[model samples]
Target chain A: MTDLPIVLRFDDVSVRHSGSHVDAIHGCSLEMKEGEHVALLGLNGSGKTSLLMAAAGLLPHEGTIDVDGIRLENSSLAEVRRRIGFLFSTPEDQLLFPRVLDDVAFSLTTQGRKEGEAREESERMLEAMGVGALANAAPYELSFGQKMRVALSGALVHKPRLLLLDEPSGALDPPGKRALAALFAAHPSAMLIATHDLVFAERCCDRFILLEAGKVVRDTVQIGEITL
Target chain B: MTVPHAHPAHPLARLCGGAILLCGCLVADHTTVAGLIVLPAVALSALLLQRTRLTSMARLMLAGTLFYLPVVVLASPGVALKGLSAAIVGVATVSSLGPQALHDAIIRMPLPALVRLLVLQMVHQAEVLRRESVRIHQALVVRGGVDGIRGIWEFAKAIPVVWLPRVLFRADRVGMAMDMRGYGAIVPAARSVRWRGIDFGVVFGSLGVAVAAVWFSALVLI
Candidate 1:
């Protein structure tokens, strides 16, 4: 396990939102081994989202970040993003295509794959996520839980090495949460999930990193062993 | 999980039908009674075929007519009527065809790649804005910002102040998401839609209507 390659690394990173003077994430550092699932736990505005966004190269940050051994920089941004799958807190924002299948096929199509091939792969992914029946349905017609599953399908379709999820359990009911946990457990990609649901984190992740005011306050193998 | 239109008319057929109807209306003299009759008739026919609720259609017509009332006063009633008729037909065609179907058709059309992309992006941003507006409106209502006539007025006043910033922020986030997912790297291949017998009938029928309208207009002029 120690010899496994690092899938993600954030080295002394600080991030400030545009037009804001205060940093949302300040001097945070962490690393994840290949296929390791890490839960990021924090209060609202504790910079869990900022850290994830920074690692995805969505926000300008000081210091360095790496994905799949590739540095996150303007020139390397595309390559880095290609190696990571990002899920927003609101699934609506990520599911852009009118049809569910088209949305799932987008990343592959953009990578210059043939349309038929991309769609075939997307259909398979949707089937795996248990949303195969919704391939032709419009995004507006779906229930929240169904929409979440479709969005997850879209994220995972391209088969990236790492996943970055923000508040993934926010809209899910208990059963939906459990289903999501099971889905993550089955996927091989390393994940950095920013969430408030301790139970969800415990079910899917092997490590927990708690953030307080943009700093890593706790890093533990067992979340139950630590006091918040 | 089925699409809204279980057996939708082919998108090309819908597009051609709308275009033909619009052209027919535009070619006829604004003051001609036949043109006025035909325009509303075509719109009504489209609405009926789409199974649109009568109450909703009436509400839309009322709002649209009220919006063009200024044109009736400032320009001429005939010009206003023409504009209203065109708008009605446009709306009916869009409702019948569905935005997703329309989008698919437009992308597949023999247009330049940039133009297709521009249309797609515009449609997407419009949807985003609409969704945000609905959310903001609901929030306002739930928070007691809406109660009576005065509340409605205040809510209307607050829209620009509240909605614009939120929509802009959301648009930025959505754009970032798109970029991260490699949106513009390559043009997506168009999906093929099955055409039916009704599709051919629609195109031919529209052409016939357009031709008859043009002939009728010429006869009236003579």
Candidate 2:
């Protein structure tokens, strides 16, 4: 009978791959408010994507990434991951299940639901995301737009509290980019999207953080407060 | 405490029964050749499950058979003709069965074993092919050879050059895709969960049937 207070806070967090001399990121921190739409903008290799990955707990990092005041470490990661959904760039890489239904269903496997319940949930989510017909299609057969939609559904089906997306409009065309901005507007989950698409960053995100060389260059603009 | 399967209560039973059948048959070996005869029928059934265009499958089968004929002949030397015939029959059986039975068979298997199977059979084979090609290319590069197999001079010189980059490019793409999907990165931990006594009984019963099949098949065949 209590609401889960979902919060994500990063403090002095940096990720250095094992055996690498140069850190991917260095001493960068940000706190995401509940239900905030945040955009991460960076020149290539500025560690924006790395920061998002660390926040999602997809990669190991030093310092602390706190989810709702609890830091990411040990068995707590499972609980943290349960509350966060993540998508890596490249549909070719991220969407791997031979069939679309299976890809969506695979997201539910960890939740340990009955097959019927899982199937229903998967179908409902796909339909809601507007890729219902793709349930039987192969991931390779999908267009860039369709794959984006499928990946979104897979990330959202469990209804996670935080959604992390890397390069949401990287490969998309004009209409596709517009559609994605629309998708972002409709979603309820708190999100951190890392991208070089400035137009997309402007339209899709309410708060923008510009990153440069493993550090924040400017924390400017609140789209919700100011007109584009 | 709960499982992914809809009819969760009988999971171990189903797994035990299925494993007993497949492993029992594999161990039964040559004696289970009769069981293997059911392979074609099963392969054909896959067409139904996938709803494949039968004509397309037939074309693929014919092409596959032709390609396989020489390899089977070369591998089995003395009995090439006989073994090749048997192998052709074997492919037909497997093709008919489709992959559903195999899917069912695999579902019972432990997750690590399933992934290991994919890596060993699929990824490992790709790796070996690429490694061998790289070695051959290095040899050609060292001998002051013009690299390609285009326009005679360019073509011959290109053969050594293209294969490495082309194969490597594809592998990189596939590798990135797998990594994004959490392949080999997420390891499933084994947890102790209790099941009903019926689950235990069903599994044991499956094991018994498997033992009997192998024992009886050996006695009869020998």
Which of the numbered candidates is closest to the native, going by highest DockQ? 1
Model 2 over residues B1-222: C-alpha lDDT tens digits?
Answer: 001223333433454444444455445424244433333333343233223355656765676567556856567422332233334333332333223223333344565665744633252334335444565566655665645542345434656577657657556654643433344433222224466876666566546655665565455331
lDDT of 1 by residue, B83-202 (tens): 887777667666656658777866776678878777776676666566667677777787875766766666688777897777777778888888888776766677677778898887
lDDT, model 2, position A169: 85
TM-score of 2: 0.62
Model 1 lDDT at residue A28: 85
TM-score of chain B of each: 0.78, 0.36
DockQ of 1: 0.58
Candidate 2's residue-wise lDDT over A110-135, tens digit each?
A: 56655567678999999987789989
Fnat per model, in the order given? 0.63, 0.16
For each candidate, what is the lDDT?
0.80, 0.61
